[model samples]
Target chain A: MVHADSSRFAAGMSTKEVYAQVLEQARTLFDGQRNWVCNFSNTAALLWHAYHSLPAPSNAVNWSGFYFTNPSNPRQLILGPFQGQVACQSIAYGRGVCGKAADTKVTQLVEDVEKFPGHIACDGASKSEIVVPIVKDGKVVAIIDIDCAELNGFTSEDQAALEELAQLLAESCDF
Target chain B: MVHADSSRFAAGMSTKEVYAQVLEQARTLFDGQRNWVCNFSNTAALLWHAYHSLPAPSNAVNWSGFYFTNPSNPRQLILGPFQGQVACQSIAYGRGVCGKAADTKVTQLVEDVEKFPGHIACDGASKSEIVVPIVKDGKVVAIIDIDCAELNGFTSEDQAALEELAQLLAESCDF
Candidate 1:
């Protein structure tokens, strides 16, 4: 009975059919939805309205978000569930590029952010970025941030479709 | 120099000139930015992209966000900065209608969340709601939840223009 009918995910599809219908509507709107803030607030509003009609430089996605690790600041990184603008709420673990992708767990393809050296502009028109980390079981439970205004806006098929939607949000939220 | 240029707060105004140019662009993008999570992440992306071109039973805004007070449960409320959909992360201090607008600090105009009795659906196509509260020195800092699919869809001129943008975000952020 998976039917929250988001108009059956419509809108001029094809960016690989909108990330394959946004990873099959984030596994039917998050299987078993164990409330990680309501499955990261409906998976950050289904990746900010499914990359707003993907065509040009990945449809110029201004920003899309998530950033976790607040078991009382596990080395820092708060601000979770987002859409866009006004950010930089925590990020300390290693410092920038979302604390070096949460201290190198992996996935940071930052195409520009003015040559990413401790880049934390937050949104001075975020020119390009991508950070994915959601490694449960062994740890690192969340991290998926995306920003773009243009310059080299993300792709290796948008980082293998956001690392398979961050491994189905680290096996269906509950972080 | 207030140049955070959110495309000069675009969109064809009117709704009292887009809430008086979104309270003068949230006081020039939050005057003297004291950083309450970057001024509620650019005042919830300037009221979810400035009410997306108003006029559809008041531009059917599905949601816009912010909900603070949870530094290890300071009476509860664990979700801040939002856009739409997944919600209800934490809410105690009086519960629902964003904890009675943070325990009656004020502003909870529900034109109809199927008759707000303890209404906490999160987002089943949110029928109508508005909850201002961002007190400051006198207390209760943070809470601006807006949602609408239609039904009465907010007015008292959007509760006195979001209670004057929640008294200018409780006198400009840094909560």
Candidate 2:
């Protein structure tokens, strides 16, 4: 059930339903996997399918992945598992959307990446973005980062769903 | 130049040319970064674009990634950075293509995965596979695993090119 066949999102599924399945599948995939590497890797793949399986905005997602808190340097976030083109290897705390999320430990849902001050363009195709910090034991462990090709690609419902997924990741991973 | 923009594979390129560019770009990407996690993650993305940028069997690739030797359990390969659906969490040495590569420290290129005894089907869509071992200090550290949708997906050229990549990884990564 943890393999790829079990992850296929059926046709005509709502975005809410898609993400719901994503969360449920992620939970099933990562149930006993405590290693952050494996968990984040599968999470990225799970998000990739969930978004592409939908229509319009969510289907336009160009990237879905994680930026883990570098153990050697907590102030910097290191690129982890991702489903996209090559990305920025490291982002300093408070530098960009990802950094802001990590520094503030709050979700950042930007309608337009270009308009976000000091945005780090990992992919030029990314028009909108969302980042949710994964907090464990009162400290940030990692962040879920998603980028879409359309402006205002994500809604508050997405944030709510992803935040719940973040909560799941916070408890699921050993990072 | 480490960003994703530089990863674009132009239209109308040969598989050999694409891989050459992949290797060149990978060297530049990994120039200053020694962490295996980042290197492997970016490498997967790079390969994803490279293969999809090509035609036929190469473009049919559904999975590209690495499975690192578990630090605590050397005989097992823990899933690492990847671009695909959720994959198997771990494969024991000599258990499958990835495992065989790790166990033998040699590249395993199978035209049809089903024909390969003891193959592990992480994705049912994967019909062919290639696994290249990254050897460090005369020991296997990790393996590059690529899966494709059609039979006879990989060739001797792919093996040679990825063997060169394995050498690059062996030298570049700390792990």
Candidate 3:
């Protein structure tokens, strides 16, 4: 069942209002369901829905989803449930944008995929991307990756808000 | 391992070239993978990445994904793997844009979401959307739904190309 309360956010809202609401929604949704899969699934959907509906730069969001550390292989990150196209099955540590984020436990804010050295062109159309690691007990358990059609699509606000959401997920959900 | 052949499509290319290449890539990627999840997953990712990277209009794509008929509940469309934000988990027959497309077995190219009556406000930022039903054996199997941040984001070419891709999926992948 989908959330019937679609009026939670308006289309004309600023990026800050939209993201703040998204984070709030994440907390509410995640609190009710502490499972990692359920939480990530709903959170991804929330992020996608909010960003696409928000005003520009945030409205330019094309891809909003997650990739988690492959339990079978600790050093690799496997595709978790996401909302976009067929992505790479697994990414090794320090390999691509996701890999670097996982390795360093730092968010990688890529302004342009074309300029990012050794960028993994999983989706050729993704011009810019941001990968935020969900750190649990000082270890990155998963990453939230968002792609946009426009270069420099993400701003400091996006980073701060997403990082806050990542912290919330790490604290609340068991991944 | 990810696809290392990033030189196949250049950023400066035309939308037609990018979309054509995306279709080709879909074919190659879906060759041995007939599972619906694999096909839809890759297809959504492919569309999201390609459309975002393409020149404006097409590059304005914010959400590119699918909705398939729920096996347990045939009259409804269950959310499938997608590339955008959180979407309606289940849509009844003849309801919103996706439901109408699935119900009528016709493509719905909505130039403006605001004008489309009964428009399900899943993503407020989506100004325009296109839904193409994937018919298999005279029955509606699935629908490819793409949303854009700008109004009138989809052109006739997008419709034709996506319909073709939908047909390919209908024939090649098993739900």
Candidate 4:
């Protein structure tokens, strides 16, 4: 039973349990809230705190955020709401992890960012990352990006849950 | 000297010195960039990391973020980029601390949010808060909000620096 005023969630829950709660809370939070700014902002906060509430490498996550297709420049992605250190403000459509997701319209589960070609190292502590594109009408509208301090921090479970979240976002948000 | 990719600043600096760097960084970050989302996102990031790099009460800050006037619903402000737990998605104009600042178009440096009438407690840990409205053409387009974990955590100096930042936001960003 989470309160509306507090972002705190039950700690020590399994990662799957946490992700499930995130989706549940997101549904409740997104109820009647069609604004992308509000939805993405809260989602970033939820993912950031959710990962921190987990154990071991999950807790080592250093970034959780979103990058939206720049309305000003459809060829690039602009920074959206996020909970992390300052990041690159914009990434070209086909460059970097976020851009790759945006360009390919595919989820990128990078086990080690250093090994990924053309990786943009925004935070030195970020060793691993996963990016999921929020596609709308067969086009990439936005991307959810999470970074961890440890290599191989995200699992296939994360990708699956986030892909589900992307679907919900596509349907729920009026972006 | 701090690197462009790293949000980490010099840790031993005074609050004033840190704020100075924040402004400098803001100028540089905002250089030729007019997108409000990118500007606000980076500004929140700078403020969050700047406070964290400081000493004592400054480092005790828990929330740093922004809220923008919703175009679809001009009577309310929607959440923006932030580096803290999830916050209230929307606050009607003239309602809470943020709204008071938005309505009054004045800097609100509340030492005790509990005593402030209509204080919206998004984070229970927030004891003090500073909200500065960014006015554009005689209307508030957005606001810069920061929350601290300790009572009386902010000083007159904080208000001055934030007000200055507000002016910069008005000039540097196109909302």
Using DockQ, give the best candidate's number: 2
Instruction: Give the DockQ of candidate 1.
Output: 0.10
Candidate 4: misplaced stretches above 4 Å? A1-6, B1-6
Tens digits of per-residue lDDT, candidate 1, B1-175, equal: 2223452445566788888877877787665445565567667777777776677766788778877776555787766667765555567878878889898888888888888887877667878888888888887877888888888888798889888888888887665
TM-scores of the candidates are: 0.32, 0.97, 0.60, 0.96
User: Lowest summed lDDT over 10 consecutive residues: which window, candidate 3 chain B?
Assistant: B1-10
Per-residue accuracy of model 4 over B35-91 as CA lDDT, tens digit each: 888888888888989999988788988889999999877779998888888788889
Residue pairs with clashing backbones, model 2: none
Q: Candidate 3 lDDT, tens digit per residue, A42-145?
A: 67777877877776676777667888886657788766657654567567988889999999998999999889878888777789999999999998899999
- The best candidate by TM-score is 2
Per-candidate local distance difference test = 0.74, 0.90, 0.78, 0.87
TM-score of 3: 0.60
DockQ of each: 0.10, 0.73, 0.17, 0.57
Q: A1-175, model 1: which lDDT tens digit per residue?
A: 2233431347678777877877776776666445565566557667777787666677688778777776755777776667765465567877778778877878898889888887877667778889888888877767888888888888798899898888888888767
Provide all candidates' interface root-mean-square deviations: 9.4, 1.6, 5.3, 2.7
| Backbone Cα, N, C clashes tallied per candidate | 1, 0, 15, 0
Question: True contacts preserved, each candidate?
Answer: 0.24, 0.75, 0.27, 0.58
Q: Which structure is stronger by TM-score: 1 or 3? A: 3
